[model samples]
Target: MDLFLSAAFGFPTVLFTPMLIVVLGYWIFVIVGAADTEMLDSVDTGGDAAGLSAVLSKAGLGRVPVTVALTMLICVAWFVSMMGSIVTSLIETVSTPMLWALGAVVLLIALVAAWAVTSGVVMGFQRFLPKRRGDSKHELVGRTCLIRIGEAHEDFGQAEITTAGGAAISIPVRTTGGEVLSVGSTALIFDHDAADDHFLVTAFDPALDPGQH
Candidate 1:
């Protein structure tokens, strides 16, 4: 127990200990709904996080959420560093300077190993994760949807549409010419506003549907 504690709190392992603690705390907050998994996703576009994002992208770890990638990285690095520290601690008659040098090498190796392992793990799991893409957005342009919100106006609205795959999803909607669509009302999605990422909708009349004729 004493040796484990000494190795954990010692150099190299010490560098990743704080990061591991932070990752654990953040996950606890996420489990309690106090934080979101995507909270750090937008941080990759700008600020200091951009540099980190670039590095992860280069490492093929960009497909996963920043928090997830970071958590895996810190966890793997901490474990590797802890093991390295324990191994080095077992070495007797090593001068203080030599131990420090060995710790530095361990830190570097830990980082590389973490990246390699995390990248493989991410690739293996990424296929099972839901993909965020607009490939099907165009298919919804001419579909009819039921208004899910109380009212859909020119500025704001939401409606539920079923895809060809039988999956239902809620999408932002808008009306033109001061059209008002209320809940339980059916609306036709005639166009998609790419700039605002919303669908243009108007009230639907079942009798007017060409498919019925």
Candidate 2:
């Protein structure tokens, strides 16, 4: 204990060790979080079906909120402890060996704690994210929606469709075969083109489809 206290009270390394760990670990998390990996390719982001499977697969962080909070807490604590250690060391009159021992013990504890937190976050993310099911765009092909804005020509337009949960989405749409869809007219999502970021639609009267043929 004497050796530990003396080392901690004399060496500058002890004061900055925790701060280094925290900063370094945080950058690691950021890189993992933002990377678009192959594992995320299977998840879907279509309307209500969007979930965390893609996010976690790419970043390896369980829940976004938990990962963010834990990282921030670790960083804050590290810097705070680092500053505190420096002040305490300056005021102390301890022996060199003792201070060194204390610094070693503190660094070990901080390192272990940081590792545990990182592992926990990774595990949590893997466990909570759901497995991908299937493509939903295929099902939208025959569904009807209303033109919320301008006409849907071969090039550009917008429309609104109520999704499975009744949530509405204003998405870019186009006429499947150059048919013009006027405002408030009913249209069907005939095709979805990811590259163009728009849906190929067709004008259709629901009442006519129902009876008049």
Candidate 3:
């Protein structure tokens, strides 16, 4: 028990311990319905998350949700580091500095091994996961959505739309002609802005909906 605690709190393994805790907490929240599994699905192009996403994509781990990939990565890293630390503790003759150096080496190996293992697992299960349909973007056009953010204007907005599968998804939206689309207001997705990766919307009246008649 002492050795297990020591390894978990020791140098290299300690680096990943907090991450593992966070991953565990996130999953707990997911299981309780307090968080969404796809909460981190969207990556801001200019942020650090985007860089990490690019790296994961290059490593073939991008097909899965970022949350899933990161959870697997941290779990694998923590386990490997813990094992390495346990093995290092068995070497009694090593000086403090030498042990630190060895821990650093273990950390590096753990990271690489985690990525490799995650990539292989992701590839093996990719076919079983729901594939994102490219045509869905075009299909969203002409759909009615509810504004989910503050007032939507030419520059910024967000809305929620339900798909044929009954899953609600939030999407980036933009308005033209200075329309007043506020939270809870209905909007029509008239067109898709492929260049900006958002939907072009206009204010909608629920009474005007043909289905209401």
Candidate 4:
């Protein structure tokens, strides 16, 4: 064991002790947290929780939250090594040149490990995040819809439609005064009501075309 340690790190066993401890602790924390989030996606929660995930979603971490956390942990490790009396005691008494080289090597390894762990976690979770919801303003134009609820007469109503491929759609409905629709009535989609975020619809009947008798 001693010969292997010396050959690998070019240092005595004692010198490699701290590096192994820090690396082990870092891997345990990051891997366990990642596994926990992966399990949570299976159960439906009211969307309330706080932890590493909350940190990832803040305007800053869109692509990789784990990477941010790993970077932070590595920085903390370096600061602790430099400032903590115990860490200073362990490495400071050693030869200055050897200590400096070891510190540089350890810090580099920590950074690379952090980056790899972060990239893996982010790639794994990207697929599980819920996709953006709700129809866009442009898509509501010219599509047929049904009155789901509410009246459409110089006022407001709710409706649902399906795209030609059967994907469900939702839109708000309204009509000129004195017009109203009940459940299951078909309406022509015409315009969008920006103020209410609803769709303006007109009664559409296929039998009564302008060119037909």
What digit string (tens of lDDT, one per residue) describes model 3 on residues 1-213?
A: 999999999989999999999999999999999988766654341212244555677788878777899999999999999999999899986588899899999999999999989998999998898863222787888989999969888989988876543456678999988876889999999999888899999989989989678
Which candidate number has the best lDDT? 3
Model 3: which residue pairs collide?
Answer: none
Q: Write candidate 4's Cα lDDT for 90-174 as tens digits.
A: 5545687866666666555544544455556556776885542224555657766777765666666777775332245455678
- In angstroms, the error of model 1 at 160 is 25
Q: Can you rank all candidates by TM-score, best first?
A: 3, 1, 2, 4
Estimate every model's Cα lDDT from 0 to 1.
0.81, 0.58, 0.82, 0.52
Residues 132-176, model 2: lDDT tens digits? 343466666677778976777888788877654334557788885
On TM-score, the leading prediction is: 3
For model 3, the stretches where C-alpha displacement exceeds 4 angstroms are: 43-55, 133-137, 144-186, 193-200, 206-213
| Model 4's TM-score against the true structure | 0.34
Per-residue lDDT of 1-115 in model 1, one digit per residue for the tens? 9999999999999999999999999999999999877555432101122444556766788777678899999999999999999999988855989999989999999999999
Candidate 1: Cα lDDT at 177: 99
- Could you tally the backbone clashes for each prediction? 0, 9, 0, 1
Task: Show the lowest summed lDDT stretch of 10 residues, model 3.
Answer: 42-51
Off by over 4 Å in 2: 1-45, 48-135, 208-213
Candidate 2 — number of clashing residue pairs?
9
lDDT score of residue 132 within candidate 2 = 30
Error of 2 at 103 (Å): 37
**Whole-model lDDT for model 3 versus the true structure?**
0.82
